[model samples]
Target: MTDRTLYIVVCGAPLASRVGDGVRQARDRGWSPYVIPTDAALPWLEDQDLGGAPVITGNRKLGESRRTPKADAVVVAPLTFNSLNAWANGNATTYPLTTLCAALGSRTPTVAVPFAKHDLAAHPAWLASLAVLRYAGVAVVDPHDGSAVSLEPITSGTGDAVTQAFEWDWALDRL
Candidate 1:
């Protein structure tokens, strides 16, 4: 196995059911994956096994001891707009996902594949936060176009389109 371990953080999104697919994809590509879930995304991981990757969640206290040591990268799949805003505004410690995002900071190569509705993506604060994060060196990617996918309105995404838009390869490329 490669020395690269990907910490895949899952947030609450409709496509969260496919998180296992993300883990499998990462592993197949030679990076071991540790699936960490936000509280809202916990159900999607219910009764599922992610090879040997820890599903750390439950208020972020689930697997501190078992974390993939020095994960070469962090990929937040299905990153919700709320987490984006919070992470941008120094609200990191408030929730599990944001806490990890904040703690990892710019030290770790982090990629965020956002999944949000059109309206949330259009908010000024959302736009500003994304820009700020990018400036701070976080790779905030859009799942749909393989582009930065900043705070602008996503033109073609909904349902399966949204699911299909998740760019697994692009995420790894950023790291």
Candidate 2:
């Protein structure tokens, strides 16, 4: 119901399956939520989801068919380790990542919340990519960084745990 649009990019994480919660939260916060799902996250979203906002897919062309509203800001929630690494290394293989890259290039207000097991975060490439994104002006929210979002490690396959642990609203507020 608001003019301001918040682009929520959902990556392939366990929490991505419940992205609806954050979409609703964004709406409650007076933001028109637009969903951009990474290739790996698409299976979680049903056709009727998102309350009719234009849903962008990863395998698609650069331009979406629908006349989507311009994003006032962006949030990539549950940013998976794979996606983050790809994004940081300038590999915009998916539409979601490509959009995020464009927003960063244009200096849009963008926030990314990485969600992965502790082991993934310990990877050298993952650590380096976090810095790359931060250096490019994205607010990368780390679970151990002692920030607003107190991220906890959710088991890889537990739907309930993933839904409960993900900081959906926290990521939305930053946008």
Candidate 3:
């Protein structure tokens, strides 16, 4: 594999169930991929096979050394409404959030694919948070098609279909 390290920050969403696809895709591209899932995402990953990519959860103890290597790039796929808002506001209340904040602060190349229901996306806070992330130079992509130029909300009942069609190349290609 190449010397590049790709950190895939997964959130709680239907799309998260397909994280194994991303891990395999990253490895095939010659990059070492790591999964950093939000606590809520744990259940989704239970049935996934992430190849050999390590899943990093919880924060390290004060004296503990870092577990994963420094990231060459980061992909936050299926970024939920809650996590997206928290990350945009710089709230590192959780391990996944902390990782996202650090990646943004360090200027690490990052691509985020937001997966929110249409109703949630209609909230004023949704667009505001997205704007905040865009201002921070994070590439915001549409999980439906990996379009960086626009982000559309997922229809309430279409999550499963959308997730099935999602490809890791969407986020990876952006990086």
TM-score of each: 0.82, 0.82, 0.97
In angstroms, the error of model 1 at 77 is: 0.8
Once fitted onto the true fold, the runs of candidate 1 whose alpha carbons sit more than 4 angstroms away are 47-49, 59-67, 103-106, 149-157
Candidate 2 backbone collisions, by pair: none
Q: Local error of candidate 3 at 13, Å?
A: 0.3
lDDT per residue (tens digit) for residues 72-161 in model 1: 778887778888888777776544555456545747778887777878877878778788768777887767666865433445456467
lDDT of 2: 0.75
Question: In model 2, where is the ten-residue run with the lowest total lDDT?
Answer: 143-152
> Which residue pairs clash in candidate 1?
none
**Per-residue C-alpha lDDT of model 2 across residues 1-175, encoded as one tens digit per residue:** 5988889898876667767877888888898988898778887786435776668764645674744567789988778889889888888776787888888888889888778787776788877888798889888664334264344444456545655655665666566
Give RMSD to native, each candidate: 3.1, 3.1, 0.8
lDDT of each: 0.72, 0.75, 0.93
Worst 10 residues of 3 by lDDT: 141-150
Model 1 — TM-score against the truth? 0.82
Higher-lDDT candidate of 1 and 3: 3
Candidate 3 per-residue C-alpha lDDT over 1-175 given as tens digits, one digit per residue, 9 for 90 to 100: 4799999999999999999999998988988999999988999999889997899999999999999999999999889999999999999999899999999999999999999998999999999999999999999989888888989999989999999999889888989
Regarding lDDT, does 1 or 2 come out ahead?
2
Candidate 3 segments exceeding 4 Å error: none
